[model samples]
Target: MSITSAERRSKDAIKARIKKIVQKRQSRRRCKLSDEELVLLALANSSDQWLMTAQIGEFAMSNSFFQKQAAQFLFGRTSLHASPQGIGSLPSRIESYLRTYGIPVHSKVDDENNKVYSMTAGAAYALLEGSYKKRSKATEKKLTTCPLLEIPIEIRMKIYHLVLKVSGFRLLVGTQSLSVYDDKITTWESRSQDALKMPPLNNFLALLSVNKQVYNEAMPEFYHENHFQFRDMGSMKNFLHNIGSERRKHMRNVSVSYYNLSAAAAGARLLAESDTLQKLTLTISATKDPAGHFTVNSSRRRFSSLTQIPGFSSMKRLRGVQQLVFNPRLEHDVVDAFLRPIITAPKPSKLSRKKKSNKRKRKHSELMSNHEAGQPAVKVSKIG
Candidate 1:
């Protein structure tokens, strides 16, 4: 029997609602059952919590899901297996998706192997929060997934602290170039690349210079461990002048190796005023004593002796000094001269002592009068 026009319209509306509901459910499942789900599934199947990627892959191959455009690929090879394709391409595809969400996948070099994929805390959050559907389709530009760019500055700083906790202190020392968040491109050659290569620290600093947000976030990281490796005098002077007005609090650790006494002096001057500098490692390459004068060989002012500079006497400005390592070959006298202010006892404050004595006398007289009169007197003392 043929259906009536009104009945057909009613049927179509019901079918549409059902389809929408199904789509929503599938999307939720896809988001919830991530590659991490593969591990759970593996445990259920083999009663083993620790299994290799290969084992997980084998388990994914056994559990089949009917194809739907609702992000089924997230649970490993379901989407790929559904297509009219072989399973060989599944590893690379999974790797790509994992990387897009900032997951760390282990790999070996020489033989060029991308190994088991593991989730970072950031990646796990990204996976949970990531939307599977294409929201804006007008332009196909690469989408930025970093929450750092989207969140408010206050929240971003908290997030940065979280990132630091996850990445650790060694992160600053690992590489200067590798950014915490960056775009990914799929190239034929790079698809098989063993390790991801990033720009040098200088290049990363240059990138930070381009935008205010990047500059604000990156400046501390850029100067966290300042290093001035100089080959000549001109570059050394220029570097010192450039960083003269910069906030010294960020210069926590500094390393300077200079070619001559002048360069070393310039470096020393820059570091002397650094209020927050805690650890300093200095290496002087010049044979001449630090006290020796370098003539005005160039247009810049040449100092006859570094001992005359106020900055040399003001090394105590770095009140947070913890570790000081100097090259053994460096002159003890020169190092001593630089470090004397830090090591020597501070001069007694005549003004402070006089004021304290007057106050003490007044207190003593008050206390004697209080004792004779049977009244209470208060005492003040400094607490360390």
Candidate 2:
């Protein structure tokens, strides 16, 4: 069965030439195709076809050039073959290619009751760029139907401000620790304990929780336009702390009631530091002395402490405090004594000035009279 040496050499030479010819053909085919051309060719052949992973492998196997190019495009590899077993269970690269061309592949039952894949008419048209026109028309219809989005943003914000205005004077009340005598429930607890059960209702404030955009638009109006009332400085401090620093910037008008010197000082310090505070209305409720009488001296001392607080003393340092209104108005003398030193221009003491002026006039008249009567005028020196 052994062949001659010359015959064997001749057969080996023929095999080498065949191999060279095949390689040349493959190289030529690869050079002829671009990425876009390969994609277009694959899509055109599979248009409106529900191709499974196995079916796509068959198509790749038929064309050696396509298989090599497809593997490069899909998996970024050059040596892989386009066969059912070679592609494995999931052809992710192939699926991506199909999806990029707008081919919608869905699974369905074939006539033999086996699951098979199919493409929709939309996918077929998408290959030819017909679907883009349809999508553009649908988008235009949606934009035209929604008239609210079409209005100018500036005008929309104005409408939001008007609609979100607080209905009445906004009074922010805090829970005092007291016994509840209600028929339904009786307990000695802070109102904050029941805060979870009964939440305070502010219709205007409800707008803040709607969504991000609405909250942003409505919050500034809510804080700046409405007057906020707090029972005491403590309650106001707590509210401010809870709202955090960012939101506290919008608060313009604040009303608080003070019952003691410490409370007034604390409240003054807080308001002094606020960047956007325009008006502060302080209602000083008269506190009783040990004798149980509302003492003027005690009220005066408390008001004095407020002006002396380090934060409140430097009024010029505050950015935007234009007005300070006191309720149950204090006497003019009391205001001039304590508040005017901090808030207003210092006027010379009227009584002292008047006394000095009168004394000068009397001395001048005495000198004139003495000179006219031919008596030597004696000057009286001031003695301590």
Candidate 3:
């Protein structure tokens, strides 16, 4: 949820009004408010409905010196001590004066046996309805900046996960990087559980564009956690290439079903090198003309084109988690051959590059010696 500029202006106006009332009421009480005005001001401004003396006092103390004058007015000194009488009597005095002025206070005992106070509904509504007397030093506002990066990394990751996780649906990303809409064609596709939990794709993706630090931290939480579905292989290639090859390492679960073969080769080339890809599903749509039939030569050519994409070499390797589904009409034997997984096994250390280099150096030295001695140089076989 977000506040519009108009909503923010309204909230600021309400705060200004409340501050004005607090100042006017303080003047009415002849500058001996015993902390009533300050307590009212704090309660009105707080996001929390109910707050204790310690919470209110902490709020007041953290504010400007002008605000702290209430505590001094109550304690008859600059600083307050934790005497039983000092802390205990302050809220009672504040509550007593506030009630007499018809600005109601709702009091309840917290688990700690201390008073938790909030404004009554009527008083709160009345505060918002009134007009502020005038703008002055008392109503000056301070802008607060959030220290997002200062938060602990573990906590930040939890926040990122909570905000970014989308389950039970695939993000239908197109050439625009994303395209979500209602289609009368499908029943359950419209009410996607996981995607709805997130903001609109554009809004959610804007989180990545915030700054380098936020982008670095949140990018993985989004890309790695969600299953992305593409309209065609071209969009998939565009998304991966535009985000950069380094970020493509996070491409885990992805699906693409395409009628056109234009993007097949480029998309496959990216996937071949994108060693981090865990799960992939590729569904090749049946290609045909408006008449819904293909000539023998055309069908053969079409099958040949599909096999060339990502090529047998790259496909025989793998995208770990992505399940590639080929056209049922296509040859299962050829498709199965391509989809077969393979991992490169390291060669024996004895056949390492250092030994190969040394062998070449030795052969060159021997040939030089034989030539100098006017003898024929023996041919050396190439190292396997």
Candidate 4:
């Protein structure tokens, strides 16, 4: 029957907030609107509903500010002598006033040739008293949101580095999921670890779950930069099977201690698939002799222990590894045996080729110099 007091109060509150904003901004205008006219305009624009010129003009005409030429006021004319080019700028100026409070509006023409306006989803119009701080806090984000997809991939990768990269980070991979190993934690745990024990979780892995784009960009940063270590070659082989090829493609460095023949070989075979691998380091950390019939020194199990592992055929599969280093503790012959497969007949790099060319030129110069001096070139001997 009659408007409820709650409805009346809400109407008063919206009108008051809009009135204050419109009045304050319109105060600087050459032609200012009266309180009734401003309140009417503010209420008409407060909701997202469209307001045509005729409808808005009725409100203006009801007030003393506009008895005639309501159309001129609806158009851009701020004063009677305002330029014709100013048409449409008045509504935009009003919209600008609303924009200052984070409520923005957009306009379109209806079938009746009436220009109507509605709010854009782009704003959080928090005009109530307590809501000012909340809206103000979000203003910067609203202005600065450059979508993650829009960012250049190179810059995005650097950003990924900030979130995901860990310097000197060594992840201990297992048969399934694995824990991280700090430098303080040596790789000497018992072989039969409980599978139930949760592998320590890495926070950076959260980047993968953010979205597909971030996951794609972040994968290389986390996997490529960090060195992966294995307790034994056996675990590495199992991990190689389970580590998604997409992720494994980014891996750079890997180190595994020799504990089993079949595992070392099988893992090496799997590792050869990665063209991105830069280095492979094998450590001979086995304290006891393996179950092989090698006729080497019986007392020194460590040295002979390495040479006996028959994974050499599998070790050669690592064509992707730029450098293959063996733990210094192993005998040189043993290291060389494993090294031959991974780095045998290594492709010469530019620097090595340059060095070889320089060596030839130097030898030629020395030979010519010796000949000119009528002295036999002293035979150069390399003392091993």
Candidate 5:
């Protein structure tokens, strides 16, 4: 085991070099800024920006990568020791350092007597430029993966319909004066009335704007599922025109209110053009007297004119017509009597043929009886 002095010196040198490298690495690790320090630096650099210690702790905790560093800063060997009484030991230590650095601190006592800390103007600026911006970008990147877009198209459409479809009819009314469209003098009055209040459609519009493919899938579900109500023919016409022909094909149920026959006729004509419309609920406003009979002369006249209007007459031509509901306020039997001829199939002429057959049988029986009685043969004249 005996060694030369030169050999011993060489071995000693190697050991000393290794020890130095280990010491350097330890020093570097110890000197590294803790999460609390980074947060303080961030708050200090933000001029006039205030933050509570709890908020800082929350931020550090939420970013799990910084959790250990924050713990080390709060309770490590270099941290301050304070009494466990009054205002909390941890916060007291933090406050002492903030004061030592001459970093202006604002303290507010809450209802529970807990102190909240905030940075004032005198805190030293230590955070590097773009640090906050980088953090914000990182957070935003984490939120960009939307689960909604990942779902199957059929499921997404169902969800969209659930969200966008109205529970009942959606009323579309005009807020301005009405005007003629296509040179027709429609009975739909001035459109300058307050429309019925409705739930917001902004969410549906926002969903549609997500992308072109999403818009294509959701638009049909939104239009096809809900029943649309229009105050008059003019408003319905405007709505149809605005939605364009492509979307119009998805429209199915429509409810319209008309003050006059002309308006009803006009609305019917417009609805007749919609190839997809299956149900039409026509609401006619007819004022009644104390006896429950229609009181307005104009109303009676308009009701009679319903059958005469070209648009009203053409309702039979609507291939998709299924249900027609008149306002329940009017007499159902009376209305049915009038509309039965217009909308129902014509009856067969079986009653007239049965009556003629019975008469011929009666005449033959009488002639047989007379012949059996031995009466002279009476000449029977042919009845036309």
Candidate 6:
């Protein structure tokens, strides 16, 4: 049959509405909620509360539509109101309830092990109403045992600060590597170049991924003093690639062994990128190779190239550098080169004069006694 344009447009509109209705029906089915169930659910969720639908079912055990009411209360009316799978909809329903009231629920699929329902005092009060007053009061009275977010902000901040202070990055443990490195040390080999090739900073950074809070808080400290093992050139390149210039600015101390000179050079390059490195501690080993076979020729090499790096040159202004030590092999030249700038930096005249004046005053006071005052004393003329 030939249809008129107006009739065709009306048919199209009807089809669109039907599609929407079907989509909505499918959605409700996914969440497993019904109309009458939704009304009860809304009343149950009137307060910002998180109770499992099973708890609501227990609450309404006498009701004929307990299963339906529990399902609706737990999930919410989705388009799937026809055959709502209440048991399957529990998680989504709980999520919906929490999100609807703007409450932040720390939910995890892994949280199945700890089914804790956290809520504010006011929310809890509203949820309990007068029905569970005594039990709610008893529960709330034990607020001292609650988590930080459960407490007031001021108390929470103090608690967070304490946690932060106590939860700083622990010492990096390289037991296996240290054992191997120690063996090389016993052989009197220069191992700095090899050590420089493998950096340990990445391993330390992995510690941050242990948990969410740790990632948030310990990241800065973890990267603050990035120490690269420098066992190979690969580790050196990895550190440079992973830790960028801006982050290196927070770097204060870099410990490089003689075996990992490449790593040291990479580190020096990385440090040189940062204008904020205050100190560089070189842990030069007496051994030369990985297996500890020979001694590296110290006179043939120097970290002078590091001084030329942009980051290292600016390191002089960082002000916290108080000491530098070189292994006996490079002690004469390397130690000299490292210390020369620090030693050459200007000393305060006030401090020198103060020390001299205090010494002279003490000496004179020691020599002078009440009985010695009776003897004539000869004063020397000032050369000035």
TM-score of each: 0.33, 0.38, 0.43, 0.42, 0.40, 0.33
Total colliding residue pairs, candidate 2: 1
Per-residue lDDT tens digits for candidate 3, residues 1-384, read: 776898677766777766555555454334423355567666777633789876777777665554447456545564556442455567767777767766667789888886788864335536434423223333443112236677899998898887776655567777443543332223224335232344666755776775688878998888778767776667777777887777777777766664345565676667666655666655543344455432221234434343454333454555344354444554344344435444222222555758998989998999999999999987768999
Residue 133, candidate 4: Cα error in Å is 29
Rank order by lDDT, top first?
A: 3, 4, 5, 2, 1, 6
Off by over 4 Å in 1: 1-147, 152-198, 206-210, 225-228, 231-234, 247-249, 262-267, 285-311, 314-317, 337-384
TM-score of predicted model 4? 0.42
Number of colliding residue pairs in each model? 0, 1, 7, 1, 3, 42
- Clashing residue pairs, candidate 1? none
The clash number for model 6 is 42
Q: State the C-alpha lDDT per candidate.
A: 0.46, 0.54, 0.60, 0.59, 0.55, 0.44
Give the backbone clash total of model 3: 7
lDDT of 6 by residue, 170-228 (tens): 22223334312332232225334233222353443554554555455555454453332
Predicted candidate 1 versus true structure: per-residue lDDT over 1-384, tens digit per residue:
676898666545544543343344344334334454443333333321233455556665555432222224433335544432334454676567656755443433323353443333333333333333332232233343443477687776564444322221211121233322211321112224443344444643464544567557856655554432333333545555675556444666554443444454555556666555666554442223355753221223445664443234445544546776665654545544556456343434679769999999988999999999998886678999
Best by the lDDT measure: 3
**Residue runs of model 6 more than 4 Å from their true location after superposition:** 1-222, 225-237, 260-264, 285-320, 325-333, 339-384
Pick by lDDT: 1 or 5, better one: 5
What is the model-wide C-alpha lDDT for candidate 3? Answer: 0.60
Model 3 lowest lDDT segment of ten: 182-191
Model 5: runs farther than 4 Å from truth?
A: 1-149, 175-198, 260-266, 285-307, 331-384
Task: Compare candidates 2 and 5 on TM-score and give the better one.
Answer: 5
**Candidate with the greatest TM-score versus the true structure:** 3
